[model samples]
Target: MRWFWIDHFVEFETGRTAAAVKNVSLAEEHLHDHFLGFAVMPSSLVIEGLAQTGGLLVGEHYQFNERVVLAKVSRASFHFMARPGDSLTYQATMQDINENGAMVAGTSHMGDRLQAEIDLVFAHLPSRENDERELFDPADFLAMLRLLRLYDVGRQSDGSPLTIPAHLLQAEQAMEAATDLN
Candidate 1:
């Protein structure tokens, strides 16, 4: 099973910026044990949430053809503890991107208060026609994007609506056909 730190995306601009929200809740299993008396969202998890937002932003830049993985956290600082009932909005802005990797500057905010700042570096795994390895199933990845409502708010650099990449669409169709065959 995949663990999603972000609940949903609220803003997305292709190859530029993205923002996602995560609602901290007492019902979460980690909150109960992370501290016996005081329930607080871990700073590590907050960084993960920011990374997820930035990672997706970077992945979409390559049309999800390249496997973008977080290479490192260059910097991270937390201002305050995120307790239950607080909503954290993570925003990521692209600092630089190229064929090899990308640099993203991100911040976490609770309403108007700044909660955390993180710097992330992502590396794009090499892909070759002969190499059949996939970091994630394309069909599942497409489904995950839909669940996040990325296309609903995403836009191209030219300000056009974002469309599903042809490769991903074909993968989803093939998966559905194989499922029907069974």
Candidate 2:
């Protein structure tokens, strides 16, 4: 699956909140089909981006063990259009978290302008019990976590690196080297 949102974590507080950003560019292919003449980022994908950012935050809380998927979005709204050349910063705060699920609230801003806001709910499922193992794997999973820079910031509430496994790190380096060649 292509990652629709490639995020950079600016700050993360274990079980509390996280801030991230996505740089929208004209070079993206979807812009061509999203609109004929006036390209704009679709609202659905904007929500997806928010979901992705929030999902990672929620998932990390479980140490990548519990599978968390976006279960619902409530009162989601958009105020402005996001187009190429816009750098959208997304900030998500966890409202609640339990064994069953998590609730998060987020806002997307293009510079100082509010672009969108959402209240998202995510459900946690055990990986062993999940039927979509092919869709999620330890390798790609860790890569995504690294790509989001989830482990590159402050320690968790208990003071830990939120470490990524060594094997995953090696795999990520290989992937990065391969991409660099292209």
Candidate 3:
């Protein structure tokens, strides 16, 4: 099973930057066991959110052709604890990208207050052509992106709306239809 920390993207630009938000609530199961009464969000989970924000920004550069994984956390620092009713917004800016991997600097903020800063390095693992299955199910990933509303507010630096390729959309629909039949 996959777990997504970000609720949706408020801004996204290919090979550039992205901004996303995550709402912390008391109802979350993790909060129950995490220090009981003082249910502040854990620092590790906060870092995970930042990683997700940056990882996707890197993967999108290659049109998600390769598996982009968190290679290293070069740096991470937290200014304060995030409590229920707080909304953490993550901003990620790409530093560099190459055949080997990518680097991104990300920050988590609650309104104007800085909560955390993270520097991440991602390793892009190429797919083996000899493998029968596709590198990844673009369809499923597209659906997840749609659910994240990345397409809703995503735009390029020129202010034009970001558009997902038609082929990827078609692949997603086909995959969904096949699942329905089973």
Candidate that scores best on TM-score? 1
Model 3, span 7-26: residue lDDT tens: 89988998899999999999
Which regions of candidate 2 fall more than 4 Å away from where they truly are?
126-135, 158-160, 165-182
Task: Give the per-residue lDDT digits (tens) of candidate 1, residues 130-181.
Answer: 9868888899989999889898889988889999999999999999999999
Give the distance in Å from residue 93's predicted Cα in candidate 1 to where it truly belongs: 0.4
lDDT of 2 at 106: 93
Query: Model 1: which residue pairs collide?
Result: none
lDDT of each: 0.94, 0.80, 0.88
Error of 1 at 30 (Å): 0.8
Report the C-alpha displacement of residue 113, candidate 3, in angstroms.
0.6
Error of 2 at 180 (Å): 20
Backbone clashes (count) for model 2: 0
Which of 2 and 3 is the better model by lDDT?
Answer: 3
Task: Give Cα distance to truth, residue 112, candidate 2, Å.
Answer: 1.9
Q: Report the lDDT of model 1 for residue 154.
A: 94
Error at 27, model 3, angstroms: 0.7
